[model samples]
Target: MKISKQLNKLKNLNVEAEKCSTREEAKKIINKANKAQSKINK
Candidate 1:
C-alpha cells in the first residue's frame, strides 16, 4: 500500500512537472521529487 501510494504521488508529480513551461521549474520539481524518494529509500 505504501509503495503504491508513493508511486501514485510520484506519477502526479511528474505530470505536474511536465506542465512546467521552464527548464528551471521542471528541474526544481524533479530535484524535490528525488529528495523525497531518497528519504523513502533510506
Candidate 2:
C-alpha cells in the first residue's frame, strides 16, 4: 500500500514535470522528487 501510494505520488510529479517549460526544469523537479522519495525510503 505504501509503495503504491509513493508510485502514485511520483506519477503526479511526472505530470507536473511535463508542464515544465524546459528540460532542465523538468529534470530539477524530478531530481527533487527522487530525493524526497529516497528520504521516504530510508
Q: How accurate is candidate 2 locally (lDDT)?
A: 0.80
**Taking the candidates one at a time, how many backbone clashes does each contain?**
0, 0
Tens digit per residue, CA lDDT, model 1, 1-42: 466666777888899887999999988889878976875676
Tell me the alpha-carbon RMSD of every candidate.
Answer: 2.3, 3.0
* Candidate 1 global CA lDDT score: 0.80
Q: What is the TM-score of each candidate against the true structure?
A: 0.63, 0.55
Candidate 2 lDDT tens digits, 1-42? 467677777878888887889988988888978966985686
Candidate 1, which segments miss by more than 4 Å at Cα? 1-8
Query: Residue 25 deviation, candidate 1, in Å?
Result: 0.5
